[model samples]
Target: MERILREPLETYSTQKTQKFVGNPLANKLRGEYQRLLEEILPDRNRYLVVGSPGKGNWASCPWIAILDSLITDTAQSGYYPVLIFKEDMTGVYLSLNQGVTRVKEYYKRNAKNVLRVIAQDYRAKIEIDNEDLTEIDLASRNNNAKLYEAGNIIAKYYPADNLPTTTELIQDVRRFLNLYEELIFNDTQIDETKNLTALEKKQYRLHFRIERNSNIANKVKQHKGYKCEGCKFTFSSMYGSLGKEFIEAHHLIPISTLNLGNVQVNIETDFAVLCSNCHSMIHRLDDPSNLELLQKIIKDNLT
Candidate 1:
């Protein structure tokens, strides 16, 4: 990392001055440096490590990102833990960051603003490793650096002269990866704006958890009282006007497997009127169809 911080600056400048075409530094960043970082990971197969010196032109702030394989193979989308060398080569940042490419494409000239907004949204919900690292500084106004700074959800800076030991670096990466799993790859708790860019899969997955037929749902809710069957919690009683007639209709049987034979759903027998909490809890069960077991679990917890 120390070598990466120091060596790249001089090499980049020299190559750019001569109107460089091919990049040896890019090769090293993606190959050797990436391999070095990969060695520290607990399971390398779960991560996709990649580095970039620049694209067609030399980047003022080059980076090497460790991406979660399930979420993103490239840094263009989803979130990742990245090592971004400062534009001035004076320092580097280990950032838990968003992918700027997707943001830029969607938000265009206002991408920076949206990136900052999404970063705030991410920080609000998850447990952050570093409470102080809510933002980062790349010390340059380059487009990439600016986007990276705005996209930072949380970060720890490493000054060029005083970098951490390899062990410490590995620990930080592991901590950041854990956060990444919770906030980005967990496929649950995706809140805030559904229209937020770079989170198509997560947002859709959360929405797709229950494929509801609205007519059937309304009829089912009519048949069942507007109270949580699991805990007898009434939303209207708690919140008054805002929660009137508000209750979720949950299908006891898995919707995907409902097509077995010539299946027909009976609203009274197959549906449950649950509060959001109970509905979410039931989905975590191995067999959500077992309403008796779910009620027992919830009852035991209360006692």
Candidate 2:
């Protein structure tokens, strides 16, 4: 999982812009954040949009985007995404503290080599301008100062007591974000294709006549007095419509073996009611007549 970078609320520049330009950047950010949230959250499930309601000073939009992205990304990756929102001061502090702790724990578990790889990956993207030396240095210092101040404020609320180191935190975040990307883009397609192929095979092999099979199974159960001829496993309607243990009807001659002219006769003679295990074992052989071979093997194994 790659860690997503958390943009400071000031990044929206809403406070400065709201006074000067009259352009509602904060409200716009909030709306976009909510829309992104709707895309991620599960359908027909209630979720609380937790924040200081109507407090538009520090945009809560970034936090919402992070939560939505995390949830959707995790789900898309075939993993359950659990998002806990902090509505109050206590919850916010606790969650931040927990996040910090988790990040550290994650780093501790991973190897030093892995950490180095992660740092390299992150460092590669960091851009530093050297064109205007004095101005660039000043800008860099200011940015660092801002970041430090922001970190302090976050720590004030969260209180990073026994929290993970900065290095660990960075690594964890990188891993989380990476995983999210993989799930959202790569793994999702592979999973969908795999599922579709499996469904098609199932449909093709079983002919997907579920109702017909169920009816036939029921009739076979009644005909066989609800007893497996091979294993004597008895089933009744109390357990299911088919039986308590329900026998499977196996084709002595496979459906695939049917000729055009003999289709009707083939369907009629193709089935036998056997226990589930027995039915499976019957199909283990290349040909149904090779049940004799299975019987021999079983007798030999038993002896």
Global Cα lDDT for candidate 1: 0.74
Model-by-model lDDT, in order? 0.74, 0.34
Using alpha carbons, what is the TM-score of model 2?
A: 0.27
Judging by lDDT against the true structure, name the best candidate: 1
Give per-residue CA lDDT, model 2, range 1-303, as digits (tens).
011112212234334344523335445434544453344333313222222112434422223223222122221111211222122212112111111222234554343334334333433333312321111011122322222122110111221123334455444333433433333332222223323344333322332122134445455556555455455555663466556555676545443444422223233444566666765675555454354565666667777
Candidate 2 lDDT score at position 121: 43
Cα miss at 108, model 2 (Å)? Answer: 48
- Model 1: per-residue lDDT, tens digit, 1-303? 546555665565565555535567767876888888888887777678988878877788889999865445568977788988877777788898888998899989999999998899888857865354887888888987899999998998887678888778888888888887677544355434434344444433323333254556777888987989888999989999899999988877653354422335677787888899988787666566567788898889998
Where is model 1 more than 4 Å wrong at Cα? 9-19, 129-131, 185-187, 190-303
Q: Looking at model 1, report the run of 10 residues with the lowest lDDT sum.
A: 202-211
Count clashing residue pairs per candidate.
0, 15
Name the best candidate (by TM-score): 1
Q: Against the true structure, candidate 2 has what lDDT? A: 0.34
